[model samples]
Target chain A: MTDSPPREPRRLTRGEWLVIAAPAAWIALFFLAPFALIVKISLSRPAQARPPYEPVFDLASGVAGLLEKISQLGFDAYRGLAEDTLYLDSYLSSLTTAGIATLVALVAAYPFALAIARAPQKWRPILIGFAVAPFWTSFLIRVYAWIALLKDEGIINHALMSLGVIDAPLPMFATRGAVIVGIVYSYLPFMLLPLYAAIEGQDPSLREAAADLGASPRQVFLRVTLPLSKRGIVAGVLLVFIPAVGEFVIPDLLGGSDTLMIGRSLWNDFFANRDWPAASAAAVALLALLLVPILLYERAQTREGRR
Target chain B: MSARVLRNATLALGFAFLYGPIAILTAMSFNASRLVTVWGGFSTKWYSALVHDERMLQAATISLSAAALSALIATFNGLLAALALARFGAFRGRSLFAGSLYAPLVLPEVVFGLGLLLVFVALDVERGFVTLVLAHAAFTMCFATVMIHAALKDCDPTLEEAAADLGATPLRAFILVTLPLIAPSVVSAYLLAFTLSLDDFVIASFTTGPGATTLPMRIYSQVRLGVSPEVNAISTLLLGFVALILTASALLTRGRAKGGGAG
Candidate 1:
């Protein structure tokens, strides 16, 4: 690199303080405080009425009691979650569904990201904008479109009947397959966007250098392009997987009773069942599961950012 | 594989998959039939009915105000955070601070929404438009930060230094030099915040008080009631509004950059 000025540390003045304070304070109160609040509620017993958390124990109860109490938070919710087979089943199902959805999305989006990376400069924006088209509409509308298509006598059936492909109209809606389709349809862009950014950032010169050295196209791609884009793959998976894990809308609309995911369970506990503490616990546990990706993504971005 | 063939097929397929359903919905919005998803002929009858729907109209106005207000607050906070992040890297706890802002972006909306609902309840704050706006601004800041940080990381600091050398104060230099150069990201960030707020349902559901419903909440309620072509009409109109904003922005940038050769 190009380095002109000698490196020196400079203290931040009042101006810098002014720049950072507002955003920090806002995030602290609303974002961070609420997470702490949920964690607190998760430790408490279920509330039947308004403000549905009761503290597990006061701090003055002693360090031993507090630690034991904090650890019991999971079991407290788990006991309730297990007793209600629906809640437990949904949690497990959502995890599997989200995992499968992420796998499908990665398979689908990778080649597209590669294509966009190698696209002609002139058509790039047009293609990219098209990639972003789904995001331009309301999320509910997109899911509804799937509903329109996947209903038993919906457009898919209509098209298939006209073509005389099946003797019976296939049952497409309210199935695992339909739910997966909805998840993939909604998250396809999320997978593509990061993968595109990462793949595009990889220098094209490396591929040329590999070719110049008499490497075959497949060898160059497998050995060079794929490895270089692993970071993108990770980022893509994370982006798709985390949200898919907590997906409520698609499952709520398209999924059958068997498609019990954690999100819908959490939704029911609070809204339908009116078990606030258990709901808060399920939600917190979901948040805890999500924290893994959130923390990982933050760490990766920060690490990448420093360079 | 040949890059041209590979790219063409991938681009065409990807675009079709992404945009195809949306196009269908848009077309059906104007379908001159009682069947919502079935095709018959084209007319604007659904759109006309959408305008007359009092509930949807009220929700739209509420959503617009919420989006605009939250976006303004998010932009202000995001710009400053980006500035501090890009310039003042000397501070300890920078990553921690950044993480706090960025956490909401990655945390599931279900979790974040639940957490915020708890916080509001704990604080005994009434959940309504005010609560909705506060929560929206809080989480939307993550998007603003990401957009601006991406822009700032690529920006050359030499421009600011040059401005400073020419007798500009740090504040003046940033206003005159840095802001103008990075304004595209600001617009992009604002656009992102707008969409996130406009599309927010989970958070709004948790925090929005009675009768302070936004469009997504309204639509979700309507969907639970039953699917209707009226939803399609409302969606089509909203889509058109976003498209218009993006088009105007592009044209404005084009005119401003006239023959500037990618400055």
Candidate 2:
């Protein structure tokens, strides 16, 4: 965007080096190294010990020993994950729950995003700010709030009972429906913000032109507004879906035992079973599964930014 | 007119769904009934009980300290990373650094927490406050970097160049001219980091050691048993605290903008 003159190629100064080195090294060591370690552990045998896995590499072992230890890494964890129906079921359930939650969030957030986008200019900022305010409140507490309202004797059931809507309090706590509610409530903002941006940035003239051409409001939205906001819809879905898929807290707190999610299983492996290799394998598998959506989201973001 | 009415109705219902549970929880906090579902009457008994709860107090202290320390450290490093990405022209391995920095944002907490815990175990680094701070700072730094990078992108580059042209060193130019312009975002970055750390449970569950349970972890344990009015009390207080800070900052910014506009 700038027409500034190109500067001569010069070596970076110590100050510049200082600026780059710290965060670069920190991320490399802490973030990248840990991820690499998880991959390494996932390839190893689960051993009952302090580390909970046979070391993928032993520095004490010399050249031949190093080669043997390197060869020791196998696909046992992957095989176990594949062979176990529990693991497979958890993965499937996690995907289904996340998928359903994402769709619900999209439906709920679209109207809110459209409202904020089409609101008067004077009220836009305040309305958007209020929309985002609840997110700042603790996420866990928000989920917990549902327990108070969703339990058999909870507010919803109590209100329903009092109004003679039912003879008994409905079973709502620790149900799949409760889990979906928790997911939707917590992730509504993630969907709305992106949708609002997409909808708001759209040209009003196109919509007006459609309306002027005798297109119905619903027709105009489906043809123009919806198509135009496709980027936001994609972004919002991925944002809600990816996190929901691997979410540990929501499913654990709000879901029944029957509501098996890969996150909860992974946590169980790590803490309850103390099986680091298996847990690492679950994490690796989860990441591998999410790789496509993550890459797609990033590409969408970059393309949007370029525009 | 019907279309407008439909839009407004949709908006009102959306807001109601979003805020309903929170409003109920806040109201429940003040209920005299010990049971969460039963609202006997209005009272501050739960708040008084929350005040005397020693475990909650300790967890609150640990969470606040870790959040404060992590936010400060992350903000500093994040500002540097933002400068490296935004101001400094593309350098060697810039893409790699950028990718690694942003990887944490989408990475599931299970992956990150397990990986980091493995690292600490491999390194034989004891898990405690130090570990929590390190992990929190690492992830929160990414968020801070993103926020500051956006702010820097919007700022005029010439402002820094002007300062440099007026006999200031590059560092001085950044500190004197560029930093002021992005100060609001920097503050926001810190707030974001703080809240993220404070609210984090999954990672804290994995990384925390003996006697280092965070407030979220505490709340998680209590919530698992069932809804306790005490949990509501604490949640309400925390909610109030967040609301106060946000509203105050919003008003402060609005007042400043009005003053500037008048001037």
Candidate 3:
């Protein structure tokens, strides 16, 4: 063995500091800055002019002028969300819709994940490939793919009618069911991958022990498997739920006007009404609603890291 | 026996549910007929048509370049963040940095999009390719950080130490030893960021300026107008490209695994 050079003690170096500063600055400017801007914009009033929102603070003005400007930034937009039944309904509907979609995704993915986990060891990679292949495609295109199959004159309807299953094509497109299907379709991988990892990593001997003890496979699964996979279940739930809550593309492409997801409402508030402040306020409100789940996930992750 | 049959059936049905719609799209891409449900004999006319479409071609260019640039920047910065978080012990504001790094993972695209747009507007900066790159980089960086940080955490510190003991400088040891060992993570992080940037619709939709339409934005507009076989052709090509890349990478990883264990 070669003689070793002098081993240096652990210390934070200037080079490391400089390297860290790059990403830190990027995150601050691009991530935190926008969040701060959203809060500021939500407080300001929507304007008729360019950029479409009043400035909350103008440095060109002195301290007294700044105070006046700050006071001018009111809660009109938040009040708008509270006062409008449409906005209130949209919020409520988004929650219910997202919640339902998450449940649907979980139900569908659980068995799929379980099946993959239980599959022959040699086939596991191929099975996972099948599950993840679709995710590699464009998300928008995947939703569009459903449209061709779900439309009145689309493949599903045409095939069903040809088979004399129904006299007229069933109304499948532009409904809540369609929206939920879209969400489930797009998010299935998110749910399945985590659950598969959890299940696959489980101690096989526990199942063997249960089998040796004459416990039914069903009983063993219900008690040993389900409880063991709870962490993955929670992870899959949060992954599906958080994005589903603010989902825009699926509801827009698949759900009818009755869908009323806050994502679509946020889109309309900004693009259609050009109410920047109102849109900002709606986003902030949605973030606030999602904070509980986000915090829970954060805590869960920390706890998982500890484990 | 019935339970075995049931388990197999569940697997079949699950695969069907996942692959059915995608199969329809891929099949339709080859149809000679322009109709949504009808299949006249197979033809490649739409694929040829896609090549001739200027707007679509331009949008594809914008998308490819943007994804490349965004993925590159994100991978670099993310590698740095990963190093800082995983290797460095507790530092002041480390928790805040970590939290902020991860917030983008769960933040709604609409909120982030709207917020970024507002920030750009307030700054009076042009919202175009630069802004798109910035937004994509910011979000994808979080994903990259998670990946590389995990790799770094699992990395054998003793290797780098051994390299230093062999008279390599700290930076040299990192460059020569640690970087090669974690190269797979870096490559995967880049691919992840690239795919995300390529597949992104919402954030790009919010942040893009006129004449800077990405492929997803182009597809979104064409789709909103009506279903066309050309869109199917493009989707097929995109799907085929991604499938090829992923298969190659998967095989590469498998080969590497068999040759030598991952660092």
Candidate 4:
């Protein structure tokens, strides 16, 4: 391979150094260091002490004490996570639930994105604004809003009964279905924005040419439009799905006691069970499970950036 | 055409799905009845109740303070990071710096929250207003950086170079020339960070200690206990505040664009 000519490396000035170093150091301390702690803590034992975990790094006790503490750390949490069906079940269900919700949001958001993208130029901004308006509101409150709408005595039930659609109120709240609804509703904007951007960026002439070439509307859509918007679909799906997989709010509020998600399980393990090691282990596993989607999203992002 | 009808129908249904609950919740905030569902008559009693609710009020104060502090810190740091990424031209460890900066955006809140809490514990730092501000700033800085970076990327670099040619230092060139041009985006980024901090629940829940509960934390607890009209009232107020800020921001950016174009 022919190598490119070597160039002189430009030294960073003081202003450049300040700008680059500040955020890097902050993230290194607060973001990267914490992950290391999580991995370390996950290997330790749960305790009845204030911090609620054993094998603390006591700097004052010197090197011997630190090594002793390190030796005491074990895979007990991961072992427990593997042994317990609850952990595995929660992980599986969280993935499935988030997956289903992503599909539902995609199906619902695609048409919305299409409508906005194809709307009159004057109306495009307004339509897009409306799509994202819900995001300005508090997420917890939005999930809470669903509680008022889905509960037995809530608006949906009252309306159904008033219209004589049903004799008794339907059970909606605290169901897996409600959790799905909450996720889809909350994440619709995430799905819509990317899809709209993708669809809107397309050359309309291509679709017109495809139609002129004897392609049916459906055929043009499936072959041209959908394929063209594949990047958006992947971006949107991962954008919604990754967060939904580890979602703590919707499941805790909208899901029944029977509803199992890794997020809620981690919350319960840490807060309710006071098992720091277990929660850390669960978090580690959740991060591991989500690695593929996160990487895919990064790839899509880089591809988009390159364009 | 049937396709047009289908498209419009989907738009309507999608918007309804998105806004219906919010509308209903806002309406219920004015319900006279104590029961959230049954509307006895039009009233602002719940709003009044929210005003007097000590716990909710205290939480709101803390939330606002933390949001302001965190947004300030995040915006400043994000401004630096944006400059680094956009103007520094592939500095050493740039990819690693960018990775950590963006990583928090997709990292599960539960995971980040747990990690931060553990760190605070390990370091023996008290978890309260300070920790909450630190954690919120850490996560929200990425978003601010993204917004400001987009603005910086679109900026013409010659103006800054011109300032430098006029004998201004690089920092002075940035402050005098580049900063004003991107001021709108900086304000927008600040507002975005503010709202994200205010809206955070899970991370705040983990990082906050006694007496540092946020509005979302309070609302979450109350909602878990069951629905209340007071919660509705508070939520409606928050919704109105956020909408107002967002509208002002939109106008600010739009006004700047128009002014720039006219000039």
Candidate 5:
């Protein structure tokens, strides 16, 4: 009912500039500064006197630390990744686990996601909230809860015993299979949300029209629902799987200490070994490992959205 | 033998699997058994003991402070970034900036956490609450941006434009018109970031000093050594607190919707 405020026609004011600049500069200085530091440290060789000291920062500490030749800044760390059995094995294992988990999550979440989308409108929000309720708690607690459940003498075994399913307490706790189960549980919500979103967005009329044309329910789901939900499927898979690949918590907490995950190995390199350059190199490789799926799925999302 | 019944049973079982552990943990907190997970009889000893636990209280304080500070800063910055990206078209290198915003989400916690540690060590920066806040803010801010951007996407921009044409200044139009529309989303984003910062253990472990141990760090250290009924009590309390807030927010939003105030 009331008229709007008069236009001030303000330019970029000093106060506004200060407010924006401070955060931007702070993010650049610290948030991004570490990334830059790691890059510079990666190029330098690990030396005897002061460890992997960069000549740029030290100025007068050691000239031998300085490698004027760009050639010397070779892929020693990356080469280390290939020849070093530990990095090679860990990277492969992490990738394999993540891939399998993503496939399993997609298969499992697909029907549930469908059921969620097809539920009555009145019940949709409640169901959706239930799906996301687990995320409200401290994620550490959920993963830790699995520790108690999956342990040798834990409730799962105890219950199985009481039911006479097996005579012995199984060694399910620290196996790679348990690790996969934990990964799936931790990340299943991520898969469900996006898949639900995409499925919900799809035109119900398409299915109705197909039904009127004598398409079977299975045929309608396969043709009308599945292909149309590709964006969500891809989005959900990448959301769950990519992070699971580089996951430190699940693999560490639920996984066997001997699981040899790339994340744990990198943690050991930095904290236990205290080799900054080598650790940075390993991280650089990990970043490379992550970029493939990230960029691919991101591009896919953009392209699919345009359609 | 019956596929329909089988699928329905599996659905129910999945729900049980999802919630059963939490229910068990909550019950075990009250169990008289000293050995965690073994039930003997019900007692409130662990809850009573947690009240007098000095270290846990300090850790809880640190965690609350970090979550509050980090969530506040991230919400402000994230709201601004969301407005900028949603309001303005592509800039010289807009995609690069957006990519930078999300890079934290994909980076392994160990990598990001330890990488931050190395940077701090190299610079001779002390490990303290300041560093911890910065680390949590960096990661939680990404989540904040995504949450707010989602709300902004559904908003009608024509209202803002109309206000601007009717003589409202750009900032004033945003404050008076656009802000009202997205305020609930902002609150949700704030809560989401707060929970994320509260839940952080991997990043906090690397960034925090000896005196700045948050709740998650304390729990992790304890769990590594051994499980305690005290931890079960703590977990129950933490879970209940978050669940309560989320429920209240949902109810408030639904009430507003029923009142015909929200679209």
Candidate 6:
């Protein structure tokens, strides 16, 4: 461990204070405070007025006014969330879609990652760069690219028809399947990079030993390589799954109107419906759903950091 | 040999999958026909149309300025946070600070977007360019911090200690010794934040006011209506811009590596 040696406690200098205080204050004001507002607004009643929520807390109104406002807060938005089948179905569908996308990305990424990892060291960085290059491009464009390929009379259909693969253009665009492809395509690098790192870090000698001990190639992989890369798999899955669950661009651009996703729902509720409270409620619920995976990811990161 | 062939084939297929859509999009941008899939001879009419678009030009201006400003802010804040996390071993509220920094990376943009919009409403801050910059910097700073922090972790601490023992002030040592060493990473972090801001759509949607629409927002609205060759043209240009930046940075790093090797 490169932990700092013990020393007499010393006060931070002005420069040190500046270094710590600026980002902390910025995060507190922007990141932490906004979540607090979300919680407060989620508990507030929707109203037909400017800002669109009732019981607005006013600092000028004193403690008594603040207490009165607090008393007016309730779980009405959350209750609406519970009662609305749209929200429920959207949540479940989002989870299912994201879950499937993560699995597909994993299966697809593992071999590509392994191939890169097993390649000559000189080639690994170039291969990894190619894998990650697409990520640097505009995400919205990447999702939109699927539209060009998947639409009726699009490139895929045109090619398929010409090749006599199908008699007609398939109904590929504006479907849940398209949304899954978009998510998998957009986030494959997230899965690939972590898996590559883990696979590349494994000891070649351990694999040789497994093979020398009469283990078949499959057995060596199942017992040694697969188990060794478990951390990477978990990290990759969480990274892809959590973000995919809240994906808006992919579902919005690629999915049919019937496709229910929490992100799209939240957008409609806030923007189109002008239901701020409901949107906040949905955001809170989405966060709550994601907390487990996020925590797992953090734990994985900390353990890796320790190593 | 068969395994090698299989591995090579898998890699080839993977890269093809990754690049194929982008390649098609770029090709479509050059097609003269209004129809996307049809080949009516190659032309740059879409690019000219994209350039002539008033809304697109305005949105591009907004996107570029916002990305530049936000990238500056994110890089500054992120560098400070990286120093705090990497140098200041333990401190009050360190865990909370760290958590907030990392949270934005994984937290759904919808959550942050809605949250920030609500806070802006509560505070009566107008939703416009400044708000967009603030919101962008807030999230992209997390990415900036992660990149810079990794670079910092890889740095040898003894050099800083040596500087301190040589009677240089901490700030001076950082500026003269540490800053030069981490300059490449800092530049990369800045570029990363810039591109992230440029690429943003959902967060910009929530946080931006009318007349402050970004290029992505413009492209998205157009895309939702249906695919257009003009949108393809703009996307290809954006891809070219990003590719240029990437190539430049790669060369910069390679140059630095060669210089260091010689030294």
Query: Each model's C-alpha lDDT?
Result: 0.80, 0.87, 0.88, 0.89, 0.78, 0.90
Error of 4 at A136 (Å): 2.7
Best by lDDT: 6
Instruction: Output the lDDT of residue A144, model 2.
Output: 91
User: Whose lDDT is higher: candidate 1's or candidate 6's?
Assistant: 6
Model 1 stretches astray by more than 4 angstroms:
A1-12, A55-75, A203-205, A208-216, B1-6, B162-167, B248-263
Candidate 3 per-residue C-alpha lDDT over A1-307 given as tens digits, one digit per residue, 9 for 90 to 100: 1212134334557987887999999988888988898898899898998989877887788899998887777899999999999999999999999999999999999998998898889999899878977887789989999999888998899999999999899999999889999999998998998899899999999999998999998999998999999999999999999999999999999988788999999999998999999999999999999999998888777666646
Clashes of each: 1, 0, 0, 0, 0, 0
TM-score of chain A of each: 0.85, 0.94, 0.93, 0.93, 0.85, 0.94
Quality class of the docking in candidate 5, CAPRI style: acceptable
Candidate 4 Cα outliers beyond 4 Å, as residue runs: A1-11, A56-70, B259-263
Model 3 off-target regions past 4 Å?
A: A1-12, A60-62, B259-263
DockQ in order: 0.55, 0.59, 0.54, 0.62, 0.36, 0.63
Candidate 1 chain A lDDT trough over 10 residues, lowest sum = A1-10
C-alpha RMSD of candidate 6: 2.2
lDDT of 5 by residue, B22-117 (tens): 887888888889765467799999999999999999999999999999999899988877775575544333455566666777777877786677
lDDT (tens digit, per residue) of candidate 5 on A1-307: 0112133323444545543454465456556777877776765666543444443345454565554444367556567767989988889989998889899888887777777777667877887688778877788888888877888878788889889999999998877778788888888888888998999999989999999999997899889899999889989988887888878777887778778678877777766876666777887778789888888766765565335
- Tell me each candidate's i-RMS in Å: 4.0, 3.6, 6.5, 3.3, 7.1, 2.9
Please give, for residues A1-307, the per-residue lDDT of candidate 6 as tens digits: 1223255335566778978888989998899998999988899888999889885577899999999888877799999999999999999999999999999999999999999998889999889988998898899999999998999988889999999999989999989999999999999999999999999999999999999999998999999999999988999999999999999889999999999999999999999999998999999999999999998888777777757
Write candidate 2's Cα lDDT for A212-240 as tens digits: 99999899999999999998999999999
Q: What fraction of the native alpha-carbon contacts across the interface, defined at 8 angstroms, is recovered by model 4? A: 0.73
Candidate 4, A300: how far from true, in Å?
1.7
Could you tell which candidate, 1 or 3, scores higher by DockQ?
1
Q: Candidate 2's residue-wise lDDT over B117-226, tens digit each?
A: 88788789999999999889988999999988987887789888888889999989988888877787788788888888988998888888997999999988898999
lDDT of 6 by residue, B101-173 (tens): 8999899999999998987888899999989999999989999999889878867788999999999989988
